[model samples]
Structures are given as C-alpha cells and as structure tokens.
Target chain A: MSRALGIEARDRRRAMLLTAPALVWTLVFFVLPFALMAAISLWQATATGMIRTWSLDNYTAFFTRPAYLGAALNSIEITVTVTVLSVLLAYPMAWIIAEEVPRRYQRLALTLAVIPFWTSYIVRSYAWSLVLSRKGVVNDWLAGWGLPLLDLANSRAAVVIGFTHFFTMLLVLTIYASLVQLPPNLRRAAADLGAGPVAIFRHVVLPLTLPGVMVGAFLTFALCIGDYVTPQILGGGKDLALPQLVMLQVGRRADLPMASALSIVLMALVTLAYLAMARWMKEPGK
Target chain B: MIRFAVSATYMALIYAFIFLPVYVLVLFSFQDGRFPIPPFKGFSLRWHQAVLSDGHLMAALGHSFVVAVLSSAVSLLLGFLAARGLAHARLRGAGVARGLITAPLSVSYLVIGLGLLASFNLANVPLSLMTVTLGHVVINAPLCFAICASAMGAPQLAAERAARDLGAGEIRVMALVTAPMILPALVAAFLLSMTFSWDEFIIAFLLSRFDVTLPVELWSLLRSGLNPKTNAIGSLVFLVSAFAVLAAELALRRRA
Candidate 1:
C-alpha cells in the first residue's frame, strides 16, 4: 500500500511537470492577451492613451455607425464568396493531382501549386494590383484587343482575385492530400458498376473528399475574414474591411478601447462562423 | 480522349495562372521601364542598382534576418524542451493540453498582433524590435511545440524506461536517445518558424517603431502606388525566401 501510494504520487508529479510549460505559455501569451483586449474594450480611452471608467460606449458607437458596420459586413461577404470559390477551384485541381496525373508529374504539379504560396503573400497581392490597375498589364492587353478597359484594382473584385490567387494553392494541397488517401479501387468500382463519371463524382468522390473540402473552406474563410493587407492594397482605399478599421482605430485614432471593441466583435463573428462550419461538417447528411 | 485533352489544357492554364505573376515580377525587374508592369522597354539593371543603394532597405533586411534567425532559434529551444516534457508525461488531459498548444497555429496574425499590443500596453512594456521578436516567439513557439511533440509522442515508452534502467541521467537520456529521434521535427519546425518570421508583417508592423521588417517596408512602398524599384526588390526577396523553403522541403522529404 505504501509503495503503491509513492508510485502514484511520482506519476502525478511527472504529469504536472510535463503539462506545466504548455499551460503556462498558453495562459500568459494566448489567453491573457485576449483577456486584456476584452477588458480594454470596456474601458474609455483618453487622447493620452489613458483608460477611463468602463462603459458600453465603444460597442454602442460601433452599432450606431454605418461605416464600421458596413466594413464588418463587407468582410463577411468577401469571406463567404472566397470560401465558395476556393472549394469550387480546389476540388477539380485536387482531383486531377490525386487521380488523373502520373505519379512523377503529380509531384511536379503539386510543387507548382505550392510554389506561389512560398512567395511573400503581400508581394503577390501587390503584383495583382499592378496587373489589374488601369495602366497595367491586363488593361494593356484589353486595349490591344479593342476591348473595354478594366480597372479592377482598388475595387472589391480585386480583393476576390487577390485572395483566390493567394489561397487556392493551400486549398488544392489540403484537398489533394485527402483525395489521394481515398482508395482508387473504390472509385474504379463505382465506374465498373454503371455510373457515369459525373455521377460517380457526385456520389462517391464527393462524399469521400468532403472532409478536405470542409478543411479548405474553413482555412479560406478564416483567412479572408481576418485579412487586411490584401484589401488595403487592392481595394483602392474605397472598401474598408474590418482589419483596416481595427488598424485605423488603433494606429491613427490611438483609440485602443475602440479598436479592442472592434477586434472583439470581429473575433465573435469569426467564432460563430467557425462553430457553424464545425456543426455543418459534423452533420454532413443534413 | 476529349476528357484527357480538357484536363491537360486546364492544368496548363492553372499552372500559367500561378506562375504568371512571379514571371512578371522577375521580368519587370530587368526591364528599363519606370513602372511595375512591362512593355518590354529594353533591359537594364537600374532597379537592382537602386535596391543596392537603399540604406533603409539594407537595414530593414539586416534587422529582419536577425529577428527571423533569433526567433526561430529561441522557439526551437523552448519547443524541444516542452515537447520532451509532453512526451514523457502520461497526463490524463493531454489532448486538451495539445489543443491549447496548437491553437496559435490557427489564430490569425492580425488578431494575435492586436492581442500582443493590448497585453504589452497593459504590462507597460515599451514596444521595440525586441518586443516584436518576443511576439514572434510567443506565436511561433507553440507551432514548434505542436510539430515536435507530434513527432516525439510516437516513440515507445519502453525505450525511455530502458535508458533510465541503464543508469543514464534524465538529461543524458533525452539528449542521446529522444533528441536524435525528434531532430527531423526540430529542423522542420525551425524552418517553418523561420519562414513565418520572414513573411510576417502584421505583428512587426504593430509592435516595432524603429526597425521595420522587409514586409512592412514593402507595404509602405506599395501604399504610394506601383513602383518598378519596389518590384525589383520584391522579386529578389521572394526568390531568396522561396529558395530557402524549397531547400527545407527537399531536406524534409529526404529525411522522411
């Protein structure tokens, strides 16, 4: 009984030692910072960066202001559109990489997909701005063809185009990994039974790769919702996203409380979307 | 036959779409033009010449390199220790613990930067380049922990017991037996942390005042409109960083 008690105590001590670092790091860095932000959101800020008495003024101001609310709504709309587009584009690319191509070429093609992602995302977005600007390459080509000039930079369309360019590789890779893990025999068996290719895809391939689709969609949505740089560079100063608003309040306004309040709202909105997606994925049949 | 043709065509187009911007950036870097886009107005090395002369760009590049290297190094050390501790302990709540450790991986950099700013302000810590490095560490160490812990957790417990029974000290057992086993993961995590630190913009932008990173510098240059010199600099940075990632990936693949 004495020996057993000693061993149990030793085991417990070891467990505590193992888990302590991770717990402490998360508490101090992750949880504590967010908690501080939440607290700041409730306080009023002076111009001198001092906090005053707590109030709901920031939240109320957010609700009352059309511009802030509009920016938040635009973020949501962009995220949703980008998520859908990524899934549509990724599924086909994943299918080709996983099933259609030779193994050697598949490696090269997959590498190519990821190469764009390796470059600086900011630089890539800026490149899109250059290509889509009025005096840029896309319009230059249009003029040569006697087509109408396109000014996509600083427009909402530019955000969509930039995001699609930046994120499609990640979506493709995630979906491709899941797609490859699916047994080829299962797909072949479906074809062997009298199903057309599209039917087989709808019934067999789609269900099996739904997990990848969900993962890719989650990442894309999460990224788009949080992204500010892409919108700022491409949206042409006209369309303000949530992140830009948050930055403005914090950086220029020096209104940390307002910025904190706005960030918390953004966090809540994203959390709700994530939870919805989680539930939807869990109940795929419904 | 038609299906095959269609797939090939689309695949080519997709590859082109991905590569076009990269090609354009490189192409225009060599052009004698004054803008980011190209009209093929003969070749010149003027932009590269300009990049070479920019003292601010050089300083930022040096600062960025120091931060990336230092942050990755620090994160790798802390992560390895934590990962070893995680693997050795038979905790009941390990799953939840692991989830918390990996949570930083999914959180947006923007949110994390904002959180860092709020926390640092509350603590009355003056933000600087060092603070920016600390922010990177806080965000990246967990990433290293997750990667290293996953790799290390797969080892058999019996091996650890055997080392202990053989009279090896705890530190020696870890250094000789466990450390070697998780080296690949350590390397992978280090590479990832380096890449993340290099490409990082949001946190550095928010946290640092005096010394800005390359991404922040590039972003400021971009706000003024399309500059060909910006394109040249952006191309060089992209190529070097992409080469590093490619090399790391190849190394990882070989180890795997």
Candidate 2:
C-alpha cells in the first residue's frame, strides 16, 4: 500500500514537473505582464517620465477626454458594423458551399474563398488602400462607367469595408462547420411537419447555427476592435480607432500609463463581449 | 434555369469581391510606373528587382524568418510537454492550469504586445529580437497547447500505458511512444504556430528595435512612399504564405 502511495506521489510530482515550465512561463509572461499593465494604468505619464502615483488619474482622463472617448465609440461602431455585416454576408456563402457545392469540391471552394486570408494582414489592408484611393482601380472603373467617385479612401467606411472583408471569411468558416455538423434528419423532420423551405430554415437551421454565428461575431468584435493596421492604413488618420489611439500614446508620446489605460479599456470591451456571448461560445459537444 | 443563373451570378460576384484586392495588388506589382494605381503603364520586373536589391528589406525578411522559426519551436516544445503532462496525469487544478495555459489565445495581439512592452519597460529590458520572440511565444504557445491537447485521446493513452507497462522509462515512454503517436498534431501545431509568428505584426513591431521584422519594415515603406516596390514585397509574402498554407492543407489531408 505504501508502494502504491509512493507511485501516486511520484506521478503527481512528475505531472508537476512536466507542467511547471509552461505554467511558470504563462505566469511570468502573460499574467504578470497583464497585472503590470493594469497597475501602470493607474499611474500618470508626465513629460519627464511615468509617475507611479497609484491613482485613477489615467482612467479619469480616459473618461473625461473627448478624443479618447470618441475613439472608443468609433471602435464600437466599426466593430458592430463589421460583425453584423460579416454575419449577414457569410451566412449565404457558407450555406452555398455546404449545401450547394458537390461534396468533393466543397473543400476546394472553401479554400478558394479564404485564400487571401493568408496574405500578410498589413499588406491586405494596404491593398484596400490602393483599391479605394482616388486614382485607384475602383475610381478608374467608375470613371470608365461614367459614375461618380466613391470618396471612400480615407474614411470610416473604408475601415469598415476592410474589416468586413476579413471577418466575413472567418465567419464563413465557423458557420460552415456548424452547418455541416447539423444532421440532415432535422431538416427532413421539419419538412415532413409541413414546413416549407424558408420555414424549415427559419425554425431549424437558424437556431442550430446560432452558436457558431455568435462565436464568429464575438471573435470579429474582439479582433476588429483591437486592430491597428486596418484602420491606420484605411482610415488614413481622418478617424481614429481605439488601437490607433493606443499606438499613438505609446509611439509618439511614450506615455506608457495612457497606453496601458487605453489597452485595459480595449480589453474591457472584449471582456464585455465575451460575457455577452459566453453561453453560445462553447464547442457544440462541450 | 433562372434559379441556376441567380446562384451562379451570386457566386461570381462574391468570388470577385474576395479576389479583388489580391488581383489588384499582384497586377500593380508589375506596373512599370512609380505609381501603383491604374493606367497600367505596362508590365515590368523592376519593382521585384528593386525589392531583391534592397538591403534593409532583405535583412528584415531574414529577421522575420529567424524569429518565426525559433519562437514557434519554443512554443511547440512547451505546449507539447504541458499537453502531454495534463493528458497523462491526474493533477490537482488541472482545469485551472489548462485555462491559464490557453488564456492567451482569446486576447488580442495588440493588448498582449502592449502588456509585454509595458512590462519590459518596467523591467528595464531593452527592445530586441529576443524580446519579440518571447512575446511571440506567449501569444502562440496557447494555440499549440490547445491543438496538442485536443489531439491527445484514448488510443494514445492506451499506447502510453502499454509502453509504461513494458518497462519503458517515463522519458522513453514520451520520446518513443507518445511523441510518435501524436506526431501529426505536433507538426500541425508547429506549422500553425510558425505561420502565426511569421505573420504577427503588432507584437514584433512594439518589441523590436534596430532589428525590425518584415511587417514593420513594410509599414515604414508604405508610410514613406506610394511605390510599386511595396506591392512587389507584399506579393512575394502572399506567394510564400499561400505555398505554406497549401502545403499544410495537403499534409493534414494526407494524414487524415
């Protein structure tokens, strides 16, 4: 019995040994850094250096400053628009690939759909800049057709379009996974109950895919809100997103306190989003 | 016939939207003029030649490769060990440990980058490739752990037990049995991490100095001018990443 207990003890020790490096790495790197950031957010950034005053001055500044508050609001508006537009556009594309395409070609079709995602994200945003610029391809085409120029190059609409492009592909993959997992019998059962195609889809398909849509939308919100490159490239400094504001704080002013506070605010938004979608974000089996 | 036509038209429009930027980017990379916009002057390889000859850009590319490979390797090792340990042993607070390990996956890269930048500032650590690589591992190890943990299941557990019963030492059981059993997952995790670390921008941007990654270099280039050289480099990156993605897809499909 003592030998068995010894074995148990040794197993536990081995487990600890094996997991220790990663746990310690996480604690030291991820958790500690986050703690330090949160702590620094309370400090004040002066012209000379950071003042470790341990106060709410930075947070208060974030609330009181119009530019800071506007950046947050702009981030929310763009993120919400991107998330909703992505879901609406991706649902049909995902449905087409899952239900309309042949089984052998579905994989190829999906791959083709998301191929541009592998491009350097910075480059992708820059490409959008080129497309939306005054003398760029879109305007040139419009001129060829004798239509008015879009005037979209350096605007919030440009940012939203760039974001929607990326997130639509992401949502398509997630919603496709959910749609494919749904057994065909559920649809057949609804059909046999005298439901038409639209009725069956509305009653059965939409509910079953809600979790996937929610997960994708949450992901879109999280990523889009924190992104710096897309808005910095596409929005052209005329409008500022939260991330660009954070970058401006760090890069130009060297204001770690302000940057930390802005980052925490950004994280708070993502946390709120996660909490709202927590119920539907789980894996289907789990 | 009308229904079929509508479906085809919709698919065509969506595909066109999806491929528009890529097409424009690649097409203008071969533009002969200084401007990358329309009125394609004609096809030329001057921009690609220019990118190849640029010393800073070449150095940044090398830095990106080294950081991506080394950071991904470290992340894969740590993730594999933690995953194997969690799967094989019944430890206290396993759920919490798992959560801690994988928590970085959900956080934005910008926040992670900012946090690291802040902490490094507090610690008086100078910004360099080493710091950038460390930041990459923090962002990527969680992904590696999640992938590896999901791939560990009953069949592998039985094999591990058999190896242990046959008098294999703990190290041998892992090296000889478990590693080979989960080779596909390990490779997948490693490749995925490499791709992410390679493409990661914000972390490397905030953490590095003097030795910038490709993305940062490209950002400065984009900021400096509106040249087709940026298009050339961007197209090159796209081609390389596309090749990697296709190879990974083929490999994973073959294994399945």
Q: Which candidate is the best by TM-score?
A: 2
Model 1 C-alpha lDDT versus the unseen true structure: 0.82
DockQ of each: 0.62, 0.80
lDDT of 2 by residue, A170-219 (tens): 88899999999999999999999899999988889998888888988998
lDDT tens digits, residue span B1-256, model 1? 8888888887777777777778777778887877776477988899999988999888888888989999998888777776776677666777787787778777778888999998888788998889889889888989888888777654535676788779987678878887776677777888888988988899999999878998888888786778878888888889878887876777568667
The 0-to-1 C-alpha lDDT of every candidate, in the order given, reads 0.82, 0.90
Write down the worst ten-residue block by lDDT for model 1 chain B.
B152-161
Indicate which candidate wins on DockQ. Answer: 2
Top model by lDDT, which number?
2
TM-score of 1: 0.95
Q: Model 1, stretches more than 4 Å misplaced?
A: A1-15, A284-286, B153-156
Residue A48 in model 1: lDDT: 89
